[model samples]
Target: MRFLDPTKIAEVAAKFMELSSPCRLCPRKCMVDRISGQIGYCGAGSLPSHSGILQHFGEEPPLVGIGGAGTIFFTHCNMQCVYCQNFQISRGECGEFVTVEELANEMLKLQLFGASNIEPVSPAHQMHLFLEALSIAARKGLDLPVVYNSSGYDSLEALKLLRGIVHVYLPDLKYADSRMSAKYSDCEDYVEVARPAIREMYDQVGDLELDSNGRAVRGLIIRHLMLPNDISGTVETMYWIRDNLSSTVAISLMAQYSPIYEAWKFPELNRRVRASEYNKVVDLCWDIGLENVFVQELESQDLCIPDFRNEKPFSWD
Candidate 1:
């Protein structure tokens, strides 16, 4: 489907920016009037800001073909997880502020660099900014599939605005329990928010589709980062995806959780995930009839870790 049709660009851009003022961009609904320069719970301004962009190979196989997935990491996450891998970026420690014009240039830069697809990481809060950039990028001949990579806490209103714009959706079903969500990310109704948001994403992009090179062209890919001691509630999250959505949905079961940021302060999250924990969750995926699964090896912990402090958060190594 053709996204960012020139005729509809203005309408889409206006609606999404309005949400920033009331800031119902995510489940937080901080209502901080970002349009008038109020930084809400997400810690982002009216304009978009970014940490880094790279032709990343760290994503799922389909997203990381020979061309490499064009990954754009956005700063200041809506949810501040205690064990965030990219702690500095998530906490809004470092980034280069950019205008809508600059953001559009970055999207084109990724496509010009031979990226398979344009994946906007952590874009839930900046839908308006992304749409504005995508509209300009499309005019400049950026015809790659757009991947909406996010923390599953998106809003239905904002997602509805993205119906035709986004070709692929890669979202994390982080927590199944509100208590755990509140404890880890400080959002009590995370499950309430993420479930419907993920459902909306599935409705938009039904299933994973790949190009001739096995690179993702369009679809929804669910990412679940298993936390230590079952805190991530893998079983519950998996069951929801199967029972509520479908058993055939692509799942990227991540085992790369590292205790950075404030994780060391909490006993349960201070250490790495045990092999048994990862194995148990991997086994559960099969037991529950989750077919298209991408299971990472335990040793990939080191490989998957990223430090946003450096100029390139990810590397060729």
Candidate 2:
């Protein structure tokens, strides 16, 4: 496992904090002065707020070996996806604010719990705080690979800072069309923003590299959740990946889209993904010569939708 030097971590953390005041941590560039308690588009403040930290088995198989991925569910998100499963935290309805030292201890605790990697879910907005905590934890012997789990609406500047710190990049490429992105996530520039950010991630850590036990230590895994009625633009997105990125780039084509949160309000998104829809996307992956693809069973919808209100957000059984 590679860890950033404490000095470099501090430098990156400082730069991120500077970005936070003007609040350009994400593409939104809300400029709300989060340091002064002003809420931005993401609803995140200066301090890092998180809902839970646990050993999560629902992640990709490589991320979850004998010891599960150490997932820290960060509160608030740059995008307000109508069908967000973990809306309790994403909507800023639930979370606990922690200082840099306390957050460092949490990372150390996860390491002690025998986690395969430290996964920070929806971390773009609170990355500075995470880095500060990581610096402290690294010094205290937190030697696990760091997974930069994101919603894919990341800013280039923020992703650039994470070059050395993040070992595995787990990002969701939600939509290929701007119209769908605008209607669903209120981000018309999501495709434009996510593409370059993902490219940068791949440049930083090329392809997925696993250890002797087949546990992912470094690489990029692009997750595309199959939505009902092709709202996610699966075909275009897959082609884009094949043409722009690589056919061999790992893709997790998810079938676990349950109509929760405000998804019921939209007629197009008011149901789970159909078997045909899932099959079409899966078949398309093969058709496009996407060699490294992970497909989920349609029944995973019932098992993967997490309720962050509970102690254990995910239930494997």
Candidate of highest TM-score: 2
Q: Each prediction's Cα RMSD?
A: 1.4, 1.2
Clashing pairs in 1: none
TM-score each candidate.
0.96, 0.97
Q: In model 2, which regions exceed 4 Å deviation?
A: none
lDDT computed for candidate 2: 0.89
Please write out the lDDT profile of model 1 over residues 204-303, one tens digit for every residue: 9899998788988778999999888889998888998999999999999999888878999999998888899889888888998998899998898877
Computed on alpha carbons, the lDDT of every model, listed in order, comes to 0.86, 0.89
Can you give the lDDT of residue 42 in candidate 1? 83
Number of clashing residue pairs in every model?
A: 0, 0
